[model samples]
Target: MSKKIYSVICGTGKYIPTNIISNEVFLNNHFTDNSGKTFSQSNIEIIEKFEQITTINQRRFADDNLTTSDLGWLAAEDALNSSGIERESLDYIIFAQNFGELRHGNTGVDILPSLAARVKKKLNIVNPNTVAYDLLFGCPGWLQAMIQADYYIKSGEAHNVLVIGADILSRISDPHDRDSMIYADGAGATLLTSQTSNTPTGILTHKTRSDTLEYSEMLFMGDSYLPENGTKKGIYLKMHGRKLYQYALKHVPGAIQDCLNKSGVLLSDIKKVLIHQANGKMDDAILNRLYKLEGDLSVPFDVMPMTISWLGNSSVATIPTLLDLILKNELDGHKIKKGDKIIFASVGAGMNINAMIYQV
Candidate 1:
């Protein structure tokens, strides 16, 4: 029997931040359209409708003194502490992020050294062979990094990989943009070690798709909705919410289904789904549509676990954070056991969609 090497998650950690910003925080925000025209609806009306759609009631924000790199470093530290793996043994440190390091009130982002490098420095790892780098694949960045790490482990190029997803979306979010309420700050990290076995375990198969022809601008950076804000103004994270929502519902399901097929796994065997928490309703629709494609198979009551309501959409952080919580038994009524089949899927800024079928 031939043995195959797979990347198994040896440790998981998350940083959810201490500052809680509730929906009420936006009550005084003067949300405006791209053209700078204020919405006719009252802030209360807007917030209620936003909550109803995104199901985000509150979210965490990093302390003013912390930057994106700090979040990644903290989560990486936690993962390393839990794994009991010597820091010098790591072969790679991949930091999945988009916004880089934007201070609380600063419009500029600091990414010259790379967040991974910063985290490596923070951990005091001196191995130049570790190869620290950053990946900016939007919200799917973390999962994509995991896929890349899997490749490294399978190719025997790496024995241990540290994948960290961190972002302070609150810093890049335009206060005047209604979508700002959906963004948050958080980080999550995982340590993957190579395991050779006859049985297929850990990451089995994955799929990715990019629809950039027309969907390229679903999520982008643009000037704040407010024409005049007292804070230093520059491009902030913006999205065509309606278009992104529609695109996700249409493509995410098929991408996941394709991944399932690639693994030759039955949809019925998928015990849990840890998907990007971009939006609560959109995720619900994606799950429903996915099952319908498989002959209206009923979704198990706890098939999907979500933390969007409290965590908001922290870009690359969302999926990994959900994963850490589940693995640590921090999420109620959700747990992944050995031999469990799970799906990790994400759709984000590249108009990109990806999914992977994994076993534990």
Candidate 2:
């Protein structure tokens, strides 16, 4: 009388826009130092360092008119088609996004029904009870959705679940902020369902931690529409880099250890560490602590760096996009294989960290 287990029968799939923006163009034209220093020399250093560290060489961005929803739909289509799960058959869709249009006086949950209805119509589905909703947190939002979907399916409330983690992070980042220079826009989705074995295609073990006291360490607020003044329409995302890194460095390693212990896996058992690409340096530091790698370039030895430079940081979409790239021959030389266990961990606003163990 053991509990029923669920696994991803089909592997992951991804879709990135066709536009490729090189770091050189982004740095030279879009950024300049306070002293008006053009990024000629420093840009090379940044690109070289990124090249030496991760496997990523380039990243994609949606065209000027595309939003997170567009990327979400494309990625979802690829995932559903590749996963062999009919979109119409999906009993639930848990969409996690940190950036999008938020209606005044309403939570994203309120607008989710409409979006779900649209997706159903696009796919020509007729199910009435196939629930859809948005999960908002930050980088950990996607991981949070996965954990919740597991509970729903296991409880017999859902037969099939599509867990999508997406973001248009560039929409929030200060276009002029150098610290936020790497921010990019993208989306990715996954298919999860009930199965009879510990196939390990989906969630193996997941955990979350929050330090509510440090909640305001990072945040976003849109323009005020109040009155006599000319109306300004725009959203702004901010980060306290120093404080965030401090909390992340303090909590993430422990989170990884705890997840590994719970899953009865070891650090060495992980074939590739698909961590959320916040930055080249931050990801490296976390891996250094977790693996006892005594250096700042731990990522060069462990994670995918090329994607970071090429794709910048897609926030919550980072890991899945990287996973997609790896699957699509963008990672080069290294490929995910069956029986391999991959560890994915993410840290973001709300000062939260979530780690999941995935077996391929």
Candidate 3:
């Protein structure tokens, strides 16, 4: 009988920019409303409320000279170097991103040369047969890419694949908007290779869903009035936080449960859940709900590893970066061992929600 093929994670890497912006920085800058009036005490309170809700203290911003692909290349290089696989042997490159490249301080997304293709070139891979492409699946893009790569390995269509998630959301944020505090920049990558084994040890089961028909406009980027110049049209990332939060609360738990059920893994078997670093309070609530579903009210304090306190929300890069940090022993008190079960989940634009089960 043919050996059972599994796509296993061999290496992981991440790149966080040097430029840091703290909450105090926003407090120092005067913000005004669209009606040409400065925010009053009520508006000031919103900033404090954001701090309570998101638990984001600070985030990094790419230097003016750096592009989205630049961040991605740095991460990809680290992943490739650690994988011990020759660059020429890579069978595919799957790049997941929301904003391609931020220009004019996040007002535009540059897509002329695809970010994936650029990273492939920057890596100096000489093989023309290695396929490279981009995936736009909101914040869950990286996990989705992994799902795709998992299939390729299982089907014997490829031996190795690189999955990357990176974004410079700080460029496209409206500084005057409170939501600006929630966006940041970074990139993360992982290398998955096929291995013949008697038992499955990689991605066990996964599920992804979209509700764009009803919630398409919940989280998005489009033309909005720049507070600096009321008449000029500028693009910025916008979201109805409450609606998005509600949607996540309602759907994410079901997705995770469905994934667990499909994989035939019990809730007690999961060691950690690496969810997208979107909002701290909301994430905790999602975990609480998931635990309740298992008929347990007690939630482990360390089950979910978080980087949003410093990383903010880098869209697709959040999960991979957090995973890399934990795997490298950079995150305190979190460790993975063989036979450990983990769950990955995220919700983002396109009103997309997804989750996956993996064994380490």
Cα lDDT listed for each candidate: 0.91, 0.67, 0.87
Q: What TM-score goes with each of the models?
A: 0.98, 0.81, 0.95
Worst lDDT window (10 residues) for model 1? 226-235
lDDT of 2 by residue, 37-60 (tens): 445556667655555554345656
lDDT minimum window of 10 residues, candidate 3: 223-232
| Model 3 stretches with alpha carbons more than 4 Å out | 30-38, 42-44, 104-106, 224-234
Q: Listing every candidate in turn, what is its Cα RMSD in Å to the true structure after a full C-alpha superposition? A: 1.1, 5.3, 2.0
Over 4 Å off, model 2: 1-3, 26-59, 102-117, 198-202, 222-234, 293-306
Error of 2 at 164 (Å): 1.4
The TM-score, computed over Cα atoms with residue i paired to residue i, of candidate 3 is 0.95
The runs of at least 3 residues in candidate 1 whose Cα sits more than 4 Å from the true structure, single-residue gaps closed, are 229-234
On the 0 to 100 scale, the lDDT of residue 87 in model 2 is 68
Candidate 1: give the clashing pairs: 339-360
Better of 1 and 3 by lDDT: 1
- The alpha-carbon lDDT assigned to residue 299 of candidate 3 equals 81
Clashes per model (N, Cα, C within 3 A): 1, 8, 2
